[model samples]
Target: MIHRPRRLRTTPAMRALVREGALTPANLIYPMFVREGISEPTPISAMPGQYQHTLESLADAAREAVEAGVGGLMLFGIPAHTDPTGSQATSPDGILNRGLRVLREAVGDRAVIIADLCLDEFTSHGHCGVLDSEGRVDNDATLPIYAEMAVQQAKAGAHMLGLSGMMDGQVAACRAALDAAGHTDVAILSYAAKYASGFYGPFREAVDSQLKGDRRAYQMDPANRAEAMIEVELDLAEGADVVMVKPASHYLDVVADVSAQIAAPVAAYQVSGEYSMLEAAAANGWIQRERLIAESLTSIHRAGARMIATYWAVEAARMLRNSL
Candidate 1:
């Protein structure tokens, strides 16, 4: 009776003072979808509030996010055409590259702009990398293309390159390319432990992905947590400045484990499907929307994620600011 642990929970002020983890706007990165040659912001039906933004609209979006005090932004492109080799990924006029240019000019260093460096959006088949004649993801063949894409993103003024391809040696390939191009300052944020989970369903719609089959060929299986560590180690050795785990809520343990194992900064991506679920539930009066969003993000942060990429970045940040 003399030892009471409930003293800390006695009041809201006391709880705030004793809080160990927090979700701030500065820890949030807004993930945006940008398409080539657009006159209007195309609404993504699957992701209710998200859109495939035109270059001009994307600039306005970036400015709005900056005004809202979001820490960073990540860009995913939707190309008008796709080829076998995903050649558009390395072109300066590519949707992603142009979007990066627009964001850079609009934000003007007010926010960190990271480009999603992968071929899925540009490839005809919608795989993260190139495929062999048999349609298998050719890991080695994809590395060079990824490297080229990294340099192109840097050239377009991306503050960071997000290597989400999940291909072997992608980080090393990209690092070498950036160094060769004298873009030593451009950081590489590797999706080191991305799993082949069911949570990516809505994302395909958001990007208008032409994916024919699952991404299990390269993305990790959800059954193996230890394998994620191996991938993280490889990315770190290969020059990844930051390492990330995708589908954050379902893999908090993996994120925590990876954070413990790696020296690089750890990030968690709250994938589109995860966001949609929360939004749907909240719309149905199943859960308090703001509270649930903040709790989910707080859980990710508590799991040791130094940064979080989320569709609700701006909203979460606004809520956190008001709560403070």
Candidate 2:
């Protein structure tokens, strides 16, 4: 034959040399759920291998993740108390704040700590924002709450505040709060183009979310692409050091488009539902777990995600390091 495309795939060394995309432990950010009041961890039934940890165990988890070479850890709090205004979000004694302190102490700068700055976990209505008299989300009224939440996270020793609430002008509001509090060194990683999708179903279980309704009122619709670019621009203009797209596998186009349009670091979240799918397939022997995990992460990375928030961070990191 005149053309031999198989020549390049003939040897392992050749394949390795010609590989276009790569995944490493350094590119991963592990998401952890921390619950208040307990010495034992509770497993989330829908999401296998995921657990809600107490402060003590959570510190150990952070240490283990860092020891495994995971680059960062993302903290999500499952607060024990809830209120209309989510008053616990601004309290130093709140679960999220306490978890942040514990993780910061355990990791000791060995890994980057990014705290999920949202009120949903602490709010009685399980909405990301404060409700109006009509019981709908009030965007403007929520801004100050997020501002307070951001500052609290920063004060709790989080290196990066992950603004995942999807509220308009949230990034700017949090930035103002941080700067005003003299936390200029703390970075903001905004969830710029988060979509309202079914992929978040398992996550709701992971965090014990008491959501009464869908997040469509605030989160972006999956039908829109150009809107993602606008969200990215707004976040960047509002001083977001990083911007992210959620549910990375189904949204590579959004990730690539945002990466091309913005100068800041682009991140993608391979959320709980994504992990559970692969885990289920692997359990059924329909797919190879390790290989699929590596491939999925590599695809996100190749699509221009500078960082990936993944449930398989430690596992994928081990594979990548061992493969190297």
Candidate 3:
């Protein structure tokens, strides 16, 4: 009884002082969607409060994120055109590249601008890579495209590339391309342990992904935890500056495992479905929205994620700042 844990819970100050994990704006990386040929920002219905921003509005959003003291911004593009090879992804004028340029011009080193280096948003088939004669995702054929995309993104002022396609040897391919282009300074943030999970449902809508089939062939299987470590090690060996685990809430074990095994900075993506579920619960009056958001982020941090990519980054950052 003398060891009463109630002593620490007696006061807010005591609780604050004894807090084991801290969630701050510095730990956040906001994910943004940019669309081509739009005059204004358009709300994503499935993921309420998230938008597919036009160029001008994207600049505004970037500035707002920077002002919120968020650590980084990640961009995904919805292009006006789509093709089998996702050729637009490697174009400097591509929506994602353009968004990166806009953010670079607006934020001006205030926040790290990350480009999502994947083709699912641009490919007509909605696959992450090019298809073979058999209509399967040709892993080797995808490397050159990713290589070109990396250089294009680097040239567009992306401070880091989020290699989210989950292809084999993608990290090495991108690294080689970047270094060859004299973009050795641009870092690669590899989605080292991305799973082909049902949790990605909302994201497909957010990006207007036209995928006819599942990405299981390329993306990691959800049931295997040890496979995540192998993926992380492969990414590290290929020069990934940061390694990330996607749909973070369900994969904290993977996040913690990767964090323990690697020297590279660990990132966890609190993906679209994770965001939508919280929003849905809040709308139904089932949970305290603000508290849940903060707690969710705290849990990820406690699980050893050094950086978090979340739709609620700006709002969570503001809440954290206000709490202080």
lDDT of each: 0.92, 0.91, 0.93
Top-down lDDT ranking: 3, 1, 2
lDDT of candidate 1 at residue 187, scale 0 to 100:
96
Residue-wise lDDT of candidate 2 within 1-324, one digit each (tens)?
999988999988888888886767988999999998767999988778888999989988888899889999999998787898889889999999999999999997999999998888888888999999999999999999899888889989999999999999999999999999999999999999999989988988887777887789999999999999999999999999999999799999999999887778999999888999999999899998888988899999999999999998988888888887
For model 3, the superposed segments whose C-alpha errors exceed 4 Å read: none
TM-score winner, 1 or 2: 1
- RMSD in order of candidates: 1.0, 1.2, 1.0
Clash count, candidate 1: 0
Model 2 Cα shift for residue 263 (angstroms) = 2.1
Instruction: Compute the lDDT for candidate 2.
Output: 0.91
Q: What is candidate 1's TM-score against the reference? A: 0.98
Cα deviation at 31, candidate 2, in Å, is 0.3
Query: Which scores better on lDDT, 2 or 3?
Result: 3
- The digit string of per-residue lDDT tens for model 1 on 66-87 reads 8888999999999899988899
Per residue, candidate 3 scores C-alpha lDDT tens digits across 104-133 of 999988999999999899999999999999
Write down the worst ten-residue block by lDDT for model 3: 255-264
